[model samples]
Target chain A: MKLFLYLDRESVVHRLHPVTKLVALPVLFGVAMRLERLETLALLALVVVVVAALGRALDAVAGMASLLLTLLIATTLMWWLFAPQGGLLRDGFQPAALARSAGLGLRLALMVASGIVFLATTRVEDFAHGLRTLGLPYRVAFALTLAFRLVPTFVASGRAVAEAQRARGLDLDHGGLVTRMRRYTPLVVPMFLTSIRRADRLAAALETRGFGSGEKRTDLVEHRFGGRDALAAVLLVGLVAASLWGGELASQPAVQAALGSARAWLEALYAKAASRP
Target chain B: MRQRTRPGVLPGSAESLGVPRAEIARRVAECLGLVGLAGFERREPATLSGGEKQRLAIASVLAMRPSLILLDEPTTDLDPVGKGEVHAILRRLAADGLAVAVIEHETEELLDLDRILHLDAGAVRRDGPPRRLLLEVAELAAAGVEPPVAARASRWLGLAEVVREERFADEVAARGVQVERTGVRPRLATRGEAPVIEVDHLVHRYPLRDQPAVDDVSLAIRPGEFVALLGANGSGKTTLAKHLNGLLPPTSGAVRVAGHDAKKAGTAQLARHVGYVFQDPDHQIFSATVWEEMAFGPRNLGVGEDQLESRILAALEVVGLTEERDRDPFVLTKGQRQRLAVASVLATAPEILVLDEPTTGLDYNDRERMLALLADLHRRGHTVLVITHAMEVVASHCERALVMAGGKLVFDGGIPELFANDEVLARARLRAPTAWRLGRMLGLETLTPEELGAALRGGGGGNGA
Candidate 1:
């Protein structure tokens, strides 16, 4: 029923300028992607978690954990099964390949976690405002905000349509996979029609509200980069630098020793379990 | 000043057109204040209630500072309280010297307007003072507009004019028409059978809400009973009705429909007993043709082809949509689409029917037809439950009234008893039918104009016969 992911809270992360938070997402992703070490990727994920906690968006983040976990497991299994470099194990389990895939999964998880943090702390309007500030056309920014606004409306309309169909004996729950998918095919028509009608109404409403009046639009809530925003932006830049630096430092003796010891511990546990079975 | 105000040019456009920011802000605030939404400048439009959103729409229009404002059926989908609020705002706008024109089918509330332009088939049928035009009952009825009950009462009682409640009361008292206290309470014909729908301690709390949408509510509806679920917006009437059909499970309670526990029965199974008709016909309608729409329900119910064809034909005939069967559902008029929605549900052959605001956005003829259809269904032994804000519909059609307020069942009684209780009416934000109001003033408890007229002609008071 909630229309948006914008959590209304006052905290360090929430207080940062929307542009700062918006910039931090790409920065985190860019650095996390460039880094090959699992330790650095895990460290970036920890940073995202810390920021989300500071913004009191942990609840929202936690709500998404299950979906992220599914993605993680899928990506890890895909990489382990098809890894081109690592040789397969005796029983074709591919432990070394699985380890490499775990690293990739951790990197993707960090990227997704950073995106979640950014959305949870930033209001949709603020994102639009940030876009406007970033020199995007007002119409484009407005469209983005409108898209966010329509998400909840479409969700509610979809629910209503589903309920209406259900009341007429449309049993979506008790059907075969293909049958259910075919049953849902009928739902798309109504949803699309309703969405089109709503779009017409919304366009008329927007025009009546002077949406494209060719005037210099004024924002109600103005955002400025305050001291906290500046500090957060600095910290983000430092974190990105550290992550990139960690990728280079991954070949160092001590870092390699630590990674080797972690792999040893994992293999020892796997061997112990295998021997017991 | 006489230029046609094109849509899409809002007051904000003025600022974009190089108007001073201060001036635009002042105008926006003033307009919002005019619509009683002064402190809602920062509020998102989606978060507003239906009434508030309507008001905000008007405010946006008012911010344009147009000399003339036109609203098309502004109160159609709103609850009684929301309707009243919008009406008050419109009256204020008109009073402020704005040329306010409203096109609406519901005339009772608009009877106090300075002028009314009655239109039919895109032609002006009548244009005159509202009171005079409404009093011409024959012409009004010819145009498919139900004259205000007071106007009908005045015509029947030979009064010169009585559109206003106090004037009608005074005229009745002065005429010495001894309004007989018939005290005819609406009673459900007791079949003594078990109730078809039983709700006990039903409480439904939506996620992320601090309070339950449907607070602990209990009721038993017997077979063949025609009940109106009356409430203001957000009063949980729809929530409670949804529970009966198993559309929504109760947070901490139980609903039994046709001897099946609603919590246990799947909605598809519950559909056999309770058919729920949503408010917006467009939301439920998706078929390429009316026939396809009607066939959807029975097909889902897995009825045989021959029986399904029969069911579809019977439902279409009941809703008078037989001729429109081959036509695309989206191409039909709003009323036809609404009927198609009802027919689609009836195709499933439910024993209990629940319609949510079935008459909304419908013209007088369409509304009467819809109600008549429901009445016919009720006559055939289907228990009918209607969630409506139309007091006149409840007064005239339904025998029992269940009023809800603040998510609680505040009152359950006969229609006469409901109108007679001022406290309950206030709590539920419902207005008594004009006939009921006039009758109460005259110490009678009539629910409709016909009842009042009959009482007057019965020689109860020396005024009429």
Candidate 2:
């Protein structure tokens, strides 16, 4: 209901430059990667909590908690237990090891929490405008925006197809996996086919609207970078720099070895994510 | 002064290829469905379907009378009925010694084709006989395409000779008939007046549009009354309906549900008084189970779990989906999904229900089922305001009608008045119902089939009654 329902209002977060939020994601990403310390990640999580509160996105946050937690746990386990030799398990499962596991979990949680913060705060058009500002080609940017926009659109289509099927008294539930897939195959085909058709329309529409002419396009809600925006940007960059510097400053050779290991694990995580469609 | 032409000269390529202008025109007409348009050759490339573009791609090649035909997703946008016709045409073309290369979504429609090219993400995943590719490959299921309904049903029911295509089409056709029949009227009487909802000078404006989506529209609904709001696209019908439940604040007007001013009311408050259903059922359906979906609105309003159970069951009963209470709404058929949406709203028990374009893409049977549900709501004394395009729906279910033309309420009266005025109907971009059209053709006075049927039988009861 929340996904499809309209919640109309205007707020400062809504009015911010989409590019500001977009750039904020990578900054947070860098911070999460650099800030291997548990305390620093906890502070980042606190900042996210404050932003979610301000944006009135607590409900959305709570709704995504399970998925976020699952991802956090999965990533932490893969990083700590499965990333070659000398992990937390190698040191044995004791209070100190548990505390280290908690640190890994907290860092992953902060990363996910920050992502939800942006998604809940940003509108579809705001993100598109941000991409445009970043000098992404309009064709690709518009396609990305349209793809996001089609989330609700295709959901609507899926509902229609389901309803049409139901009205015909097709029992979608009383079937085996293969049977169910077979039953829904016709449904999925039509929707997939419709999406391709919609893509064609979108391409033509974008072309007609002068999407990729290398001309500046005005927006309905123009996102001007304000003094607060500059301050926020500076603050984000500072945090990432501080995290890396702090991790390096901790002189314990053991800590340095762990940090090196974490970096390798993070690279592997990114490789896996990039491999998916 | 010209020499005689050679006797062996070929006719124009279009004619030589047997690609009659009439066939192309017919295919275009069928694809457009009820949407009117001129010939495709004159239209812009921007106005064609992905399927149409593919067809045009073939048509171009075929125009030269090439011995080969390459097809891809030919009936993508086409409905079930259209898919059969197009498939048949393609088969005929193949029989005529034209080498046809076809790529399609469902194998059912393309089963009889000479060959199949199985590609997954630009790679030739498989190249084989249709029987081997379809029967042996477990990967086809993972690849997200399925055999025709007949094959599926046969496999499921453990029955031989049940081909996938046969079963699938039979299911589709049977469903279509069922939906059409559901449109028939149930036993009901004209509603009593209680003024359940009222609007005075309602207006709304989109952020950028010059004209208000809704403008100075004043109307009222009595308790248990079924009223239909009729208008063309962008006519403000949806905007006006949204105000009934406080989804939108009137720019400069008043809206009251159950005598409470909706402008000052919160959506939660409005939810208790007036349940609003969006045009798209997906807008309201996200819960995993039917029961949970029915409980969603009420739960949002802070109803306790114990009370929610009864409310859920009662609402499910009202929508005639009690049997499917545990099923996933996403898995339900089109008509069932709509009922689930209605049930979700009903669980909140609002005094008034407002629906936007409730029958936009519904088949005849599903439309009937919806009409029956609306009739039931009216009988149960709930205020029902339906925004619709179908004149048949207006004639049958709606007692009162409001017609908007260009952001103005040009007509507000009984349903009879709506069908009687040809000029007003034209201005509203509405066609008269079939009965009304027939009556007009025969120079009769009434505007509905029931009225004409009554008149033909010499019954004197007022058709309005």
The number of residue pairs in model 2 that clash at the backbone is: 21
**i-RMS, each model, one decimal:** 7.7, 20.1
Task: Give native contacts recovered, as a fraction, per prediction.
Answer: 0.59, 0.00
Across B80-106, the per-residue lDDT of candidate 1 in tens digits comes to: 778888999899888989999897889
Best model per DockQ: 1
Worst 10 residues of 1 chain A by lDDT: A87-96
- Is model 1 an incorrect, acceptable, medium or high docking prediction? acceptable
Tens digit per residue, CA lDDT, model 2, B343-400 = 7888878878888777655544566678888899889878888887666678777888
Candidate 2 off by > 4 Å: A1-277, B1-194, B443-448, B457-465
As a whole number from 0 to 100, the lDDT of residue B433 in candidate 2 is: 58
Spell out the clash pairs found in candidate 1: A207-B8, A208-B8, A215-B16, A215-B17, A216-B16, B178-B461
Cα error, candidate 1, residue B252 (Å)? 2.6
What is the per-residue lDDT of model 1 for residues A1-277, given as tens digits with 9 covering 90 to 100?
6756677666778667778877877888888778765665676777888888998999987888997898789888777776676624323775656777887988887788778878888777678778888899978987887688777778888999898998888888876899989898567888899888888987886666567676666664356778887788789778877776755677899999999999999999999999994
Worst 10 residues of 2 chain A by lDDT: A1-10
Residue B366 miss distance in model 1 (angstroms): 0.8
